[model samples]
Target chain A: MSEFFQQIINGLSLGSIYALIALGYTMVYGILKLINFAHGEVFMLGAYSGYFLASALGVERYSASGQSFPLGLALVVLLGAMALSALLGVTIEALAYRPVRSAPRLTPLITAIGASLFLQNAAVLLFTPNPRPYPPILREVRFTLGGVIVTNIKLAIFVVAIVLMIGLHQFVQRTWTGRAMRAVSMNMDAARLMGIDVNATIRATFAIGSALAAAGGILFGLDQITINPLMGVLTGLKAFVAAVLGGIGNIPGAVVGGLLIGLAEQLTAGYLSPDYRDAITFLILVVILVLKPEGLLGVVRQEKV
Target chain B: MTLVGRRWFCIAGAALLASFSACKKPGGGAAPGGSGSVTTNESSGLIVGHYASLTGNTAHFGQDTDKAVRMAVDDANASGGVLGKPVKLTTLDDRGDTAEAASAVTRLIDVEHVNALIGEVASSLSLAGGRIAQRRGIPMISPSSTNPKVTQVGDYIFRVCFIDPFQGKVMATFARNTLKLDEVAILKDVKNDYSIGLADTFKASFTALGGKIALEQSYSAGDTDFSAQVTAIKATKAQALYVPGYYSEVGAIARTARRLGLKVPLLGGDGWDAPELFSIGGDALNGSYYSNHFAPDGASPKGKAFMAAFKQKYGTEPTGLGMLGYDAAALLFDAVKRAGKLDGAAIRDALAQTKGFEGVAGTITMDKDRNPEKAAAILKIVDGKAKYEATVGP
Candidate 1:
């Protein structure tokens, strides 16, 4: 029972990170009806940017007594990564998606793939091909809840993910821009007719989603304490699965889907062979899709001509 | 009446001119001894090429090997070069792709005019490259690939590392005799030739050594969850488990196996040498052991010197892969120096005649097939660190 609870906590912690990243995917898909394959790469770039920021700020540099400086560097790194990632996201959508906005829908999908590959390889060229070592900031701190051991950093990550997710939900459901986004998503022609800038709304959606992914990526790096050029590939795939599993164009569904997938993966790994962990994740996704094609929280919308 | 005859004459003249020009080949220069402009010694300068995965998943291995070769070549050149006229080293990146590896070897032989070659970190890639080298009669040495059939292709194929057979025997002997385990379950990686080869050999050796094989299961690479397989293994009442694969899968497996309450001792091969294994596996990997060519701590004077220099250069202790790369480079240089000439045949003979040559790993002597017959060391993981346990003789 103790082991079970521990595994659950592990699952929840991982799921929360995935959920944050998936929200971005779901939000972008909702507004644009296009999968931002490069969103995952944006997450990777954010992790690297955070890493550089942390190092530049001497977060890991030991003092004379072997103690690190306590200057809120982690927060600084987070803000820096978020800002840079949002900029990159806006640029990607503007250049890649904007040009093909009126073209065939398949064109943007292909361009997204091209952008993804470009970012991945360009990262390889820009950074060292080898994995970078990420030094931990909050060491020797642990919190035990119901026999499940977790560190302060992990708790911070979970707290931040939930807070950001709730903030995003509020922003989407209550804010003026949020209504504009929903208007655009529901009927782009009507939204444009009603004096809404569909293009700007789409760009805004991408920026928000990308920022969330960036935050998730930073947290993931903090969790794993390593960064690699291809780190985003698996994360991106998982986020995509999370989006699809929750219903691609549904925002809340993406959140629930990400957490469910994360739990399923962790629980499977804890109970079964680690080799089947990824296979089981995919298998569960298939099962869910078969049982409920509309997803756990997805609203099946009727297409109105 | 005369027009038809004139046209036929002109067409015949054009045909004769075209055939005359086609008969003479272009750039037909320098037939052997044609210029007699051979003032320089042509029989001694040898060019050795390397084909490695330098730009993909396993690029680190190739990059390290390339660095080692460069270091060795620099040292050799400083000492008056191989076979007198400095040895030239060229490289091709296979990108960890087999098709690319094959074509890279073809290019190395045809375009680079290399006399000998070394490379390929993985078995499948090595085998693919080895076939081309063998058909073309080029002597190619693999630095890290350990599958048994890697050298079985032909006389020209060889490896600096121990084969899977010996590694499997080492693991089996340790499990049966040291661990005193009678029933063991096996987990193999299906997609990797290296993993499958070692697992099959370990199974054969384990069952032969008075150990009962409990169950055997397989998993493909890049798989992260193994709950179904772990549950099956747990039900088997086995005392130990053998997981033969790379570090990535092994780390996740070790963690999951413990979580499933099936904490049997796990055994593996050299692929478990990555730094990520300990962090990912954490305390789950304690008491596990793997077979490798060399351990940095258990070093002879030469090995110590090499380790010191490597640490001085790289700020970290060199792993077995790094040492093997260094040794392979040194061995090739020694052959080049002994031949005192760069001719392909002379260098091949020099390599074939290598005997009692000492490397940082161990003493190496090439057999008729050019494969090194050397002992292997068993390293134990205690407290997330690898310690040399014992050495198995040849």
Candidate 2:
């Protein structure tokens, strides 16, 4: 019915944001073989950066009339956040991950958690623990498609998310750096033997993944209309689950997982009780883990003793 | 160090520390209540301890209360201190957590040796702190915790603001009488006691008033998505939506509801009063209504003077929570003056007998339950700002 169709639209938009953030987790895990728990904090930082950039540009002052959609200003702020988040991502990798790379696997994992907590507290200390309302960048305009109300912001989020995914896909398939990334992910020692600079490749992967997450953060702020220091915690966890469900470290699987998780969450909330939304998302993860072990698109690999 | 020697040393050390703490407790208690032998020099000034969420999710509530409390203390000291001695206020940050609130109260009672306590804007936090103050027999007053269970903690606990049941009825009445909306949908935060209590009361009152509830949905606190709930409510084609949750989520809900083309005006409770409401809800909340403790935009002479004084001190408009803080402190100060002593039992008796205490929020008279019987104000969001509408009384 119309209500069903309406939920689908909501699911897709929500799924797109999850997908954008999932790509970051998948790419970093693909290259580093490490779950970057701090990636969520990176997403939070991106939202804050975008918030500051928009404020610096006087987006609020100009949009006070509520009639103007400052798309250009929004884009500028988004791109600025992307760039800053990339830098932060690279810096975190260098300081936190690189130092503990040779240590036990648990060491780096703990470091990632530590880094996440540190960044969250630092944001709290800097910004004060109040939630800031994200500036209205797009005017509130709605259009109906067969009884389903779709806003312009929702359409823009879907379009931008798809575009970014396509751009990332093409970059990975067609570029030399992308090939180097795939090479490192396959066999870091072998890639080094093949004259590939593994460290640079890893940094590049982090940068690109972080840029994608930043885009997700900005879009989420726009969609939800509020951003806080702790906003990234639950969201980051969900996207990580999405990546796992899609088969962690598999590019296409992350997209599929993100969309499926989004759809499942929205459908569950719409049809059932909202209290079960988070429970259902994790339940899917458990079912997938129990049944397949490997993700939907994940490939089984043989270990040589 | 041999094993036996180390064991004896540990036992001896623990005993020494225990005795020291035991001695300190009676010493601290004796100075205030004249019940023990130990004497202290710092008992000359009447100390009032306050704990609130000054640095966490609900920091705005605590920060506003802290400002208003400070203004009240300054005014009290300028006129004449309580018990003819300077009244000192000590505020601790509870970070909006129950465990932290309990610990904060413990510190105030045991360490600071405060004669009285004020605090904990959130009901859950107040419940935690109130239990501690009740055990210690310290008179504690909450500025804006509206849950009835707050005062039910103990006879020593009190609140200046009206409870959630009254607030819920006020909003329900406004919806049925003022807006004349017959069918409504309620989206409540199931994880929060305040929201659940308010929603229940509103639903009961609305149904009793011959108004039908078209739909009812629930969400947990801190949830960012209300799409499913909004869609469900829209499908019901209700005349209005009642969201009994805090401003953080309500603003997002309002935006989501409007985006889905549900044009009926949203109704809410005092939790919707916050500066962030405008920023998040924007023009989408233009015509929504909410019942509040006191509308800062009202034209009462007492309210106007309080607003002017608060603005002069804080350089911002006083929020409803801030006004409640000022009123609670003023009420407590009046009780202290009436008690004519720094004794907690005496102060509790005075607070119980409080009648017609003129506060900036309203004239308050404490019932047997220690809840202030006062009028609730209804405010409408017009052009992205809250305008005072009407005051509904019990």
Candidate 3:
């Protein structure tokens, strides 16, 4: 029973990060119908940026009197990561996607992949091509809930994720920009016909998605306390799976998909061979795509032949 | 004039082509060279190529190895250069992805036209990279890849690190004889050939020494929860658990095992040498034991010297990986000096002939398998530090 509950905690924590990253994928896909393959690289940049800022603050290197900002320091790192990641996302979209928007879909797809590789390699050149130990910020204290020992960090991640999801849901449902985004996603031509300023909406989608991914990246580093230049690859793949499973362009679908994938992975590791965890997650994704091509929550649109 | 779209088309074409060209300008390096290939030109200024897990999860090890290699190259160049020709090191990031490693290796051999290669701290990456060198007749020396299959890629592939057979035997011996364990279970990282090789060897050796193999399970590289594996192992009546994998997964496994009320003695190989293991496992791994190439707590004078130098350079006591890399670099330099040429084949012959070559790890002698036949030390975890236990024969 304890083991069962423990797995749930682990699943929820892992799911939260995936959900955060998936939001970026879903939002961008919703607006542009393009998978921002470089979005993962953007998350990688955020983690690396956080590492640099945190290291500069002397958090890890602190001995006796070195500069340390436990609370304010975390905030600064988070804000800096979001800012840098958002800027990178916007610049990449402008340089790589905006011009090719009208070109064949294959063109931008290949470009996004190329951009992803470029950013990944460039990061390796700029930073140490190594995993920097994420300086431990929050101390772990296990508390028993229903006989399950849960770490404070895991609980905090869950709470923070829930808050962020709620905040996002409200933003998309209540704001004027949200309606514009919906219109743009529904039909770019129609949105433009209605004076929706489609270009600006697309840019905003990229920015917001990148920011959320940055947050997820930061939280992931905080949880594991280790950051590597290529950490984003696996996480990105998993989040993409989540986004697709929940319906690529649906916001709520992304959240549901993230949690489902995370829980599935944890349960597999908890009950079966941990080696097959990722394999199983990917297999399920293939299965879902084959069975429900439109995704679990996605609306099936009829072709206007 | 409705010609505004044409301007956009030209701009997009130029930008897209620029990015594509940048990516395609450099292909992956060549295959591993054979013992008689003259692939490098010393007179033209040597290009030392390195293919490592430069951009992924295992990038930390590759980065540390790279730093040590650069340091060695700089030091060698400062000392009148290698044979009056300055050494230039070119690196390719494998991203800790296997396919990427093959491309990186190809580019290093074919495009960079490197004289000799040093790389791939991870056993899997090295195995993949080694094949490229072996197929191309290039000399590729791995600093710390411990999987036995790494050297089997070809005679051109060599590692300064001891193979899993020796390390695995050392761990098994420690568990059966030193820890007095009658029964043991093993958890290995399935995605990694190194972990699987080491675990298999340990199981074979442990079972041979009157110890029962209670249960053997597997996990991938990034798995965080181990409740089911632990639960299954708990029912097996095992007295010890052998987990051969990197520190990331091993630390999580250790903590999860403790939480499951299984206090058996845990054992592992050198992959548990990362500093993060201590932070993640904490009190969980207090009584665990692992076999490593070099123990930071070694009483040997050479070990002390290397530790001191490492501290001076990195401001932290070198992990076994760092020390192994330093030794590999120093050994490679020795072979290069003895071969008296920048030719890949000549240097490989020199490497094969190495005997009584002293290093921080120990005296490394390449066997016929192109693996270093040297002793490894057993480390016992005490208060988040790996303290020396006993040095066992190779």
lDDT of 3: 0.79
Error of 1 at A66 (Å): 7.0
Quote the positional error of residue B179 for candidate 3 in Å. 2.3
Candidate 2 structure quality by residue, lDDT tens digits, B281-335: 7788998999999887764688789899999877999899998898888888899
Ranking by DockQ: 2, 3, 1
lDDT of 3 by residue, B1-394 (tens): 1365576568557756764553433222222333124444755555678766644566567767766776677777778667777666667767788898899888778777887888788888888888888888788889999888888888888889888888889988888888888999998888788888898889899989999999888876665446667756765788889998888777767876776567897999888887878766767899889988888777468868867876797887777887777777778778888988877888889989989898877888888888878888998988877899999986
Over the true interface residues, superposed, what is the Cα RMSD of model 2?
Answer: 4.9
In model 3, the runs with Cα more than 4 Å from the true position are A49-80, A104-107, A189-195, B1-145, B150-161, B182-185, B210-215, B221-241, B247-266, B274-287, B299-373
Native-to-model Cα distance after best TM-score fit, residue B200 in candidate 2, in Å: 0.4
Which of candidates 1 and 2 reaches a greater DockQ? 2
The candidates score, on chain A by TM-score, as follows 0.95, 0.97, 0.94
Quote the positional error of residue B179 for candidate 2 in Å. 2.3
Give native contacts recovered, as a fraction, per prediction: 0.03, 0.86, 0.36
lDDT scores for all predictions?
0.77, 0.87, 0.79
TM-score of candidate 3 to 2 decimals:
0.77
Identify the CAPRI category of the predicted complex in candidate 1. Answer: incorrect
Decide which is better by lDDT, 1 or 3: 3
lDDT of 1 at B131: 97
